[model samples]
Target: MKLVNLYPQKNIEFFTPDTSTKLKLPVVTNGISAGFPSPADDFLDSSINLNKALIRNKDATFYGRVKGDSMIDAGLSDGDLLIIDKSLEPKNGKIAVCFIDGEFTVKRIKIEKDVIWLIAENIKYKPIKVTIDNDFTIWGIVTYIIKSV
Candidate 1:
């Protein structure tokens, strides 16, 4: 039997302003905790609009679903929704979606002296050094990763 992907199989694409899905959820006044117990705050005190919170630049922001485990150590996994923004500068240590040799791959940007390297979080995948022979473009900077439960 052929297996179906529960997550979308397409490259993270740009978000249009007229997307049919828009959810506005309530945001607690206090941040959710991972440590000791805290008192519960009143409900509906504030709201967290994902579009506003997640997309800093709506026009340049896009979405792509991660396809592999090459970046597991960086907290990236298969099926995670990656939020990328073209407007953001690709700085050192920032994760980016890159286009190389006509293919798209996601990796962390590393600039060492005069060289550029696409470093993978997983050891199995070797870091690729950018050279004159390769086609490369820092498509966008990853701002957030939405993990699926």
Candidate 2:
């Protein structure tokens, strides 16, 4: 699996949401069929191991399928998988996956002296400034981008 740099030439700001609250993630297990009587046990084991390796260092990153063109100018298109890491601290300029007012969105974070803003790369979309009353939450920092060709 190759990781692509989505925003290579652009300088984007990053932000971290207050993660003092605990997050509960559900555990998922890959189920195996017991009725298969093939001699491909070795192959199956190897495949599983490979899958694990591809995602081992990436356990901290959550996968979310993108749904809009707001980030297209930044090279993030619709249906792309975003690798977001919540443990990474948000900085001045980086792409991040944020949850605001019960909705999840991928945007570039900008931190001003007195305000935080969520910026969209597309001209058709408007930038969102964080307000005191808004339910804003920065879910994670986007570390890698995976797109389908």
Candidate 3:
């Protein structure tokens, strides 16, 4: 997959998903407990390929490194990796990566009768209302978010 530097000034770095790399990693069959520790035997029963597991549509999938805190309340933080699928339908309440007036932003979509609203999860950030005069496009629907602890 070809990677492109799209809208660096907009705080989003875009890259095409490399579905060709199939790296199988051991997966724990039993769920990990948050409160207590458990036995480790029989946990690694199977393997998983992250490329296959994450990329639902290889041709339409893209990765974007987030660079802002607009969606911090939604668990998307700066430096978080976002898996976006262009083939997915952009419905109301879905988190999406959008291009508006030549800038890229990730926000929850709110579909009104005649207008689209980009709602930020942070209370400090105000929602952006998209109008017909502005150039807008729902680039892709955010499917998964990979974050570092």
Candidate 4:
């Protein structure tokens, strides 16, 4: 288990989707079965533009690459690409990309009346209780996750 430093100083590497160029990819309308192998279809059902499909707010959307396994149990693994929308309102139980104490971290939001908690999906890490003393902000909400098989 070796780690590659994609961004030397950041836990999440951020990038904005280039909407100027639309790349349409063939889409399979039918669902692929996991239990058994299905016959391959030669014809594509339709084509989809990833930029249009994934991004709802082009101005506020950003792609963040996961750097650690803090949220692995939440299905956000290391090296996974996350679609973040800054315009979305922050709410309880929503997974968010947060900037805390000069560093960025992705965690599940836990709003408790006056207090807020940044929870890690993996048990190895502990839940962070955010107080007024800390410089924290919910940068964006994680809308989608892109994983490589």
Overall lDDT per candidate, in order of appearance: 0.79, 0.67, 0.90, 0.89
Q: Tens digit of lDDT per residue, candidate 2, span 1-149?
A: 33444333323322222233344433324445588754543442222232343233444655556778999999999878766677788876788888787677889999889888999999999999989899988878877667999
Alpha carbon deviation, residue 60, candidate 4 (Å): 0.3
- Show model 3 residue runs off by greater than 4 Å: 1-10
Off by over 4 Å in 4: 1-9, 37-42
User: Which candidate, 1 or 2, would have the higher TM-score against the true structure?
Assistant: 1
Pick by lDDT: 3 or 4, better one = 3
If both were scored by TM-score, which would come out higher, candidate 2 or candidate 3?
3
Span of ten consecutive residues with least summed lDDT in model 4: 1-10
Error of 1 at 77 (Å): 0.4
TM-score of 4: 0.89
lDDT of 4 by residue, 27-136 (tens): 88786778887876765788999889989998898888888999999999998989899999999999999999989999999999999999999999999999999999
Top candidate when judged by TM-score against the true structure: 3
Indicate the residue-level lDDT of 1 in model 1.
12
- C-alpha lDDT of residue 83 in model 3: 94
Which scores higher on lDDT, 2 or 3?
3
Q: Write the per-residue lDDT of candidate 1 for residues 1-149, one digit (tens) a residue.
A: 11223224335333433333466788776777889977777645776668777878876877777888899999999888788898999899999999888777899999788788999999999999998789989998999998977
lDDT of 3 by residue, 1-149 (tens): 45676555665899887677778999987877788898887668899999888888988988999888999999999999999999999999999999999888999999989999999999999999999999999999999999999
